[model samples]
Target: MTKGGMESVELFTSEGKGRGLKAQKEFLPGDVIFAEPAYAAVVFDRTSTWATTTPWGATDLGRCGWKAAIQRGTWGCWLAVADQEPAVPRGAREPMASWLGLEREGSGLAEGCLVSIDDLQNHVESFSEEEKKELRVDVESFLEFWPPQSQQFGIQFISHIFGVISCNGFTLSDQRGLQAVGVGIFPNLCQANHDCWPNCTVIFNNGNHEAVRSMFHTQMRIELRALSKISAGEELSVSYVDFLSLSEERRRQLRKQYYFDCTCEHCQKRIKDDLMLAVKAGESKPSAEAVKEVVQLSKDTLEKINKARMEGLYHEVVKLCRECLKKQEAVLGDTNIYLLRILSIASEVLSYLQMFEEAADYAKRMVDGYLKLYHPNNAQLGMAVMRAGVTHWHAGLIEAGHGLICKAYAILLITHGPSHPITKDLEVMRVQTEMELRMFQQNEFMYYKMREAALKNQKIHVMPEPSNETSPSLFHKKE
Candidate 1:
């Protein structure tokens, strides 16, 4: 596959997973796998009308609301307004209707709440009397603002949209990585299967400055990249759930939402390890009182650090983080989750303040901690390594920086691929560090040569004074 070009991948049937993309050729780490625009997207804002009354608090209800919003471009009372005046112009509505209808039909919705679209037709049919009654209230509240377009059609439409959103929506976050701003439906990205240890990741890019002037005016695209080296015929997978949690927790979450039992190699190993740990815990667990004390202390420290950060007291933030780290380390050691969390905070804050050396220290620690706890090719490890490399570079540790960057590049090449902005940024750093190292060596060599010549000239130009016994050479020459 060509660098920064189309990836060697194709869609195929994934075992256990309905459909998935597979690599068609060998992929190196940091290669761009593929880029695609979202099929449909909506920016999330808490202040929006639907945000006020939509039953999105419940997972199922939220999924339903997302689908309705995406499909009709409005929810609740707005749907009624659209029905009457048709907010979508005639020319636009036709195409939208065609797309939504096609998507809805193909979404595999079924009538039961078993997390599949295939059972959507029997959804109401299978509902218990209590469930049906509750659903009626939800549907009525959803339509409270809308004029009656057609009760039967509205009910069916809402149900189908709910199933589709539950199955397809992806959380959208802004560039800042602060919080999720919205949810979107990316048809192509939705095709990739789930793996506890995913080999690919999806990133969203909102267009340039002018484009971001208005939220609605901006165009967003989702990019998919290889997280690790994927051999030809290897299935490309992304994590659908947080993989940081233990295998049991991850499996439980996936089963609850996606309705699938994960039998992936990572999950299997984690499950086995967790079971073993549990057995050992029974034999040599810590004292309950001691554990409680440590937990409470950690919690209090974390709270204080968060408050300081919110108040923009960065110095306090760093100080608190360090204190927390010390306490956690003394009690739980470097690999403990709490210690790792504090280390991450310290690294980020220090980097933000341009304290590169200090940041590098914390980042290095984070990398080491992640390495000890996570898989070799884990995305978090890649991120920590990258941070360490960048900070080291900024701190003038050119060789260390270069080596760390290369290491990070190798790992990221497999997990994030080359086309990703992150990988691209790291490449820039790698080249820069290489150039800096060369210049530094050249300057050092020139300085040493100049010093050597200066010393030799001093020896040659200086004449030895006559010895005391021969000082009167002119008068004692005869003697």
Candidate 2:
């Protein structure tokens, strides 16, 4: 894609999928198809209570109304800070038809209560009873904060938008840790359809790692980049859910959260499903029943690990991962997705616990598995390799760590632009690791002495871990 022209992709009506973007020309890995600025971005902050004018408040209105505001694109969103003035209207609001992305010329949809809003994505129909109940709770809560002046717009409009957001809302993340900090809509981003293994990846380019606040929010934009070679006229697609998951699980998430069943090749044909769930069964080979049994067990263990990790039970996460891994390694292939999941979680959790040697081992194994499954320049692969490198570095395996770090740096240079904060940090790590590798080679004894001293003073990081922040203890001066 040309930096200035944004000509690589064009919006087209995709068969089966409605509005979708497609490659207008061939695109190599790393080529950015296009970028879309946030249509309605609101960074949630405790310091600043937000306020927006009635009917269409971007920042001020709570979640549901915020989506409606972005759809209209008329109201200026305001940050309620001391001495800060309320945002004025951008212009006269567009007609309700345009607000809904209706093509009044060909399709008469101006008067209908369609689930698809012009602000974000497609229509959604399914909502579970629990979801309906939760939505009403949200609506009731919204009513508490909603100003009476805007009561003219009936509950039907609010209910309609709540459903719109249920499926289409995008979480905004901070740059450094990729931590969720807010929500926003980039309507054009919705044009890309879903695939299990997409040729393109969406990047939230926030540019800054600082807290999402006034003025800086403008810096947030979404970029769609080719994950690999994409042929001209091929429909551009992205995964709506985690691709690491089994086809059944991935489809379930898509149907429940996104209200669409993925028709991607992997999902339709059960590609990777066997390998992901396969269990070793000696010479006889595992039966489908056997595979299902182990898969269920693995899922249960993983569910526990997730809960433990979220609850900050780092030790329990590590223990459960080890137990699962012991069973998995005995019964599953080395590259089994379930084993990979345990390794991935264990590596990070062990790192948080300051168990660098164990962490490095798990991290290396996880990276090896990822390399087999993911494209060479896959962002997740690059990050996995980078984590493995950092873990090795912390374990004082300078040479091995340096090599992996450099490899990751090269891959990330393509997947994530050098301007990206992650890529920049990896560059720094690469240089630092390279320097240490050289110094260790020059005087191995002094290096170990320094490392031991550094480790003695280093502290284990706590939960809600700071990502990629663990530096080699070589910074501490040896006595």
Q: Could you tally the backbone clashes for each prediction?
A: 29, 0
Worst lDDT run of 10 residues, candidate 2, spans 470-479
Deviating ranges (above 4 Å) for candidate 1: 2-36, 45-152, 175-179, 205-224, 228-235, 255-261, 271-296, 442-479
Leading candidate by lDDT: 2
Candidate 2's displacement at residue 156, Å, is 4.0
Q: Which lDDT value does model 2 have at 19? A: 72
Q: 199-236, model 1: which lDDT tens digit per residue?
A: 77666544333222132333356666666677989888
Residue 180 error for model 1, in Å?
3.2
Q: Would you list the C-alpha lDDT of every candidate in the order shown?
A: 0.55, 0.62
* Model 2: per-residue Cα lDDT over 101-206, one tens digit each: 3221222222211213533443424566766676566566555444465444455555655554445546555564344455554555666788878887777665
Q: Which window of 10 residues has the lowest lDDT sum in candidate 1?
A: 470-479
